[model samples]
Target: MACSACGSDSAIVCSLSDEYRDYAPADAAVISICTHCLTVDPADATSVDTGREVEPDFSRLSDSVPTRPERAIPLVLAIDLCSSIATNRSAIESLLEEVERAGTDPLLVIDRLRADPDVEPAVDLERRRHQLEQLLY
Candidate 1:
């Protein structure tokens, strides 16, 4: 459905099961937000075709299982670790300096922050570091 505010067809529609505290309606109410203007508006629940919704295929779940299970890292922790590498020298360093810092291994923190330099802000830093290294060479 097109957004009423911006008239943009590129809008995100979400189905809410309950009221969103003076924002969304309750009882499976549909809301649309314009990606352009970022306006949130109530949309007609009937406007969405519920029949087109994809059902989860449980047949794959019964299929072959991997011998080794993959470990999933929490998003918040990943973001925090990335942030520590990105802006910690300017932000967290000052905050950490006040206390009698002890028992904290600097190498451990360095290892984690540098572990996945290909991820996000770390990638940016890694690219810059590579450029600087090239210049030095």
Candidate 2:
């Protein structure tokens, strides 16, 4: 995947893993970041081993995005299991299309999507939309 920060095509995923020796919380989980951008992502973290047994490292990769994306690179990926909008590809496509057309607030587009009468609001629409909004920003 391309780097989120520098937009470099050679970007990789790395872990800023916590060392238990530091007395970190028991609930601590691996954090995955774009090695090029150092942006933390939970979604990517779960897709791989993370290999962050004791400390953070970036020398390996469990997977990679096919290549550089043509548009709408996800800058702020939600590491949590809360991104409903990601599954709603049609909604995402419409939203991105509108954003391209208006070149204005994508949040407004999301609000409109949430308010659309034909669309049955997902139980977690607001929260998922918030996650999607973070991606746009």
Q: Residues 41-117, candidate 2: write the lDDT tens digits.
A: 33344645545443323232211211221111221122122344556444454444444454435455346545655
Q: What is the C-alpha lDDT of each candidate?
A: 0.34, 0.37
Q: After best superposition, candidate 1 residue 47: deviation in angstroms?
A: 2.9
Per-residue alpha-carbon lDDT of model 1 for 1-137, expressed as tens digits?
Answer: 77655576865454443323122322226655444433445777776668776322212211211111110111111222233344433322322221114333232332343443322222233433433223223
- Tell me, what's the RMSD of every candidate? 15.0, 14.6
Which residue window of length 10 is worst by lDDT in model 1?
Answer: 65-74
Residue pairs with backbone overlap in model 1: none
TM-score of each: 0.31, 0.25
Please identify model 2 stretches exceeding 4 Å from their true place: 1-104, 121-124
